[model samples]
Target: MRRRGLAFIIVALMLGMLLAALDQTIVSTALPTIVSDLGGLEELSWVVTGYLLASTVSTPLWGKLGDQFGRKYLFVTAIVIFLVGSALCGLSSSMGQLIAYRSLQGLGGGGLMVLAQAIVGDVVSARERGKYQGWFGGVFAVASVVGPLLGGLFVDHLSWHWVFYINLPLGAVALFVIVAGLPNDKSQTRHRIDFAGVVLLGGATSCLVLLTTWGGTTYPWSDPVILGLAGAAVVLLVAWAVAERRAREPVLPLELFRLRAFTMSSAVGFVVGFAMFGALTYLPLYLQAVHGVTPTLSGLHLLPMMAGMLTMSIISGQIISRTGKYRYLPITGTAFATVGLLMLSMLTEHSSLWTMSVDLLVLGMGLGMTMQVLVIIVQNAVDFKDLGVATSGVTFFRSIGGAFGVATLGSVFSSRLNDDLSRVLARTRLPPGFDPAQVQQDPTAIQRLPPELAADFLHVYADAIATVFKVAAPIMLVAFALTWLIPQQQLRETTKAADLGEGLGATSAERSSLAEVERGLVRLADADLRRGFYARLGSLAGLDGIAPQGVWIIARLDGKGWVEAAELACRADVSRATGRPYVDQLVERGLVERSDDEDRLRLTGEGRVAAGRLTRSSLESLRGLVADWGDSPQLKRLCERITPELLGARADRPR
Candidate 1:
């Protein structure tokens, strides 16, 4: 059956991914312009880096909240938060303010991306998920190309700040669509907070991001800062694992990672992020530095990569849907990306732009095929009960990878840029007062440098770009190896209740006595017991009362045209030592069945008929006895004179 909820999820997710992915590249083209105007080029990377750091940490929190409070609400909340942050970003007056605001944006952005995908898994069945995943991939891939273009357009034709400002209205619309129409369902909530798990998870993630951000940028790998962050990460991560084992509800379910597919997919995320970002981040620089292309043109040049990604994602989704095959998609994607990355590793200052586009296309195609496919598979294999946690865990890993890639690979790029610049500057005829390091970090300085020095600096930037890609290429190979860990077991498509294996498999209809009384076909006043209601009824006519309450228990025992006296007596424990004779009297009046069993006290066809009538009467009597006082005339009159009257107050009654 088609899932009723998929459409709601798909619409919400498309918007979320559009916004999240757009943020990743939208500012790329505008970065140079923003820095030039703001005069804080030394901290240019923070605008991106701070967001990445904050967003990565926040992704898991959103996932956990989605599982706790309902994804629909959390998703809407994220959009609101993001739009607010975007508006703030547009209003920022300095580089530091922009970085702080971007960090806020990342908090919402991370939640938007992770929660949307998790919501998709919750609403759709796994086997059917690839198609939607393909759609999500298409959204992401389109954003990759369109973001830079949009950023460039805003910078060239409009103010650079419009890049952030445009998000406000789009976000408002997305939020409205989600909050106004989506069903409010907190079905996944556990009713208790996972305090320990959230604490451990947050600590673990914050430390890990710190390790990634600080290791290459702030200090050496062995320095106190790096080592301390690493140590804290390990301790918190270990504590998180232990806590999850004992937690009534966990934010980070460590058990999920034990799945081979999950492990492989997580590794794939890291590798893909490492290679993908390292390459994409520098492409704009390469265009401006080496090819002398405008930012708008650089954004336009990236369309091939986005095209490749979108096409592969959609195609893989269709293929998987048709064949029920997902195992091969990731392997193929990783392999393709690896080859493409290796090819790009050979780039030089004069490498053909068309050739670079082809390589990027190959890389994007590889990426599109795998990223969503892995998530879809992992989602499918997990029990439906853990849908939120399972989906969120994978997303969390992907974010972690993206964060690490940007920071770690960025450091590689920066270090290489520095070393290459030193070499290029060594043979220079520059005066003693000008240091290449000082100029390279400052956008205004780079723009005003002597022509030869600028050319050499640009060359250094190009070489650093190539070096990052070369290092990232090996990471792609690692991603390919990780794909092997996923078990090839076919995705077990399921419907509700399929989780109960065949050991006790039975639907409600299959194990019932299809009879008149049971089906509500028998009536006490009908004077006709269908032959079926009587069949075998005498054999088990021992029903009697054993309840602590004097009231008898009754149910339509069979679809046989009538009820059984002896069966009602035994089931409800109407004992021979007790009111057996009164029951017999009712049977004698043709109100119940009486039989020869138990000294002619057992239920017969006649007795069974009477039993249903009397039990039904007694049940109604019990119901009426307790419904005594509401709207009763006696009760109403006694309280009325003393009660305050509505709009009938007397002057003497004023208190």
Candidate 2:
């Protein structure tokens, strides 16, 4: 494809991503106004909870459907659903109507985020994807900062309804650009949709989300409704697991959990999502209720955190791209997050805005280091065939985590606030018509209260919020521990051909040529040149017995961190039958060992040492090759311009 066309498609996809991302926070600042207008203050939580429930349940389904039916048309369909739902939300006459419409919007919104990442994976090489994915992190940061401000502006000037209405023009523009720019290609392979699996998984997710949202809030933890939902969730989850094992095409493959990186990364993602979302959701409440800031001012105050996140995300991407090592980044990030949360727990009603800003910045930097890299890690770990499912799987866990975190922490906050308020109010003579419920529901209402009463309310809220943060700080420490368990895998230089196969409209002959060119490039960039350098270094390092094929296998194992024998065979372009002899050879030579389950292969300690030496040798060789070209801007420019052209020319060739 032409550069202009690819650029347009990317912009369109980002806009689509922005639409969903913005909606997650846009209504938050507008919620009080929405409740005032719609007269359903009691049901206010449903407005947010409904969207989260629908989106979480639908995320994996959209990915599976896109993989089966092809992404272009399905993605466009999602945008249309979102637009229609947005329009309906704007026109809603009641809070119940808005909540129902938001669920419909979530049905579409779920697709936007996962599909955007999958599409980028399809088009860009993993080597270059880090930089591109950094842009996504930036978009998310900007949306977080902008969404509340936009919601506040709309509520204060136009109406709370305009928050929903604003999506119309943006959605239309995204729809048009995507339809015009993205290629529509259906898969030739017949896929059986896992109908039973979908139903079971959806039910399980909905039940779990409901359990969290309602537990200790709408109902007691021991209430029959809450207990029933919890029981149903467990049953549905187990049934879904059984269904996946039997289904020909599972929506969420059971086998992915066998991979250590995928499992650990998913767990880490969930915890991070829980901590970040839980903190972000309530931080504004703290600022407005305790510090007496307006919605717009609270939004503006969040800028330092957003800036910290954006700066670190871009820097982390560059570091990962240049160094090809990402395991320690998340570990460091989690450390920062733990410290930040601990500091936040110490905040008092008298704490200055500058102190709060510094705390948030630390938290943002920690999040920046982990969030995007987790996606990249999982993408690099899985096979191309499972890419869509793997991407959506991580997203699914994160979304569920956010829902669970918010409910759990919100419950804690509510309970503490009520207890503290009651105790404080018992000691003082109350002002007439000063309803605690009204003041709690609307932070702005405190401004109209007697000054002495308002100060007490503020102090109560501040102490309660601080206790919530103290409880949350321990969660970040758990995330930090999980980060250490993720083994580092080298990022692949090329995108998997299987992922890009049908989407870009290349003919058979062009595909073959493209494949040949890509293989040649890989050999030049990864294997042949590196092996030659390693050979020379191996002799000096007393590792002279390794063959080129053995080295190739070692490289593959190192790149994947650990892979099942069948998957490793597929990656190395050999059938399982043909690959067995090679694996036997490696095992006999003591260079590879089977994991405890005896289903996967990983390098032995000796093998790891050998691999590290080879990697270092290769880097040294590349540096030597480029040594003479130092300080020459033209050489760098030429390499950049020519590399993509060499790759793109084969795609443009005629059949």
Best by lDDT: 2
Query: How many steric clashes between backbone atoms does each model show?
Result: 40, 0
What TM-score does candidate 1 get on C-alpha atoms?
Answer: 0.66
After superposition on all C-alphas, the RMSD of every candidate to the true structure, in Å, is 18.7, 15.6
The lDDT of each candidate is 0.61, 0.69
Task: Work out candidate 1's RMSD over C-alphas.
Answer: 18.7
Residue-level lDDT tens digits of model 2 in 1-655? 5667878878888888888888887777777567656765445556766676677777656766776788888888889989999999999999889989999998888788767756765565533444455565456666766877787778777888899998999989889988887777544335687889878987887787677666786788999999999999999999999999999877779999998889988887777777766776677777777777766677677767666666677677668767778899889988998898899999988999999999999988997787767766776687655655676576666666666666667677777777887898789788786667776666556667788878888788789889878988898899899999998875654322112111110001111112222332332343333235334555644566755455556656763466887876655566777666666777888889988876799899888876666565544443343333243444334344333322212121111
For candidate 1, write residues 170-277 as lDDT tens digits. 777778767766666647744455678867776776687567656665688899888988888999988888888887767656777777777677678766755665
Where does model 1 exceed 4 Å of error?
Answer: 1-17, 35-46, 63-77, 111-141, 172-190, 431-438, 442-450, 494-655
Off by over 4 Å in 2: 1-11, 32-46, 70-73, 92-95, 114-138, 176-189, 380-388, 489-655
TM-score of each: 0.66, 0.71
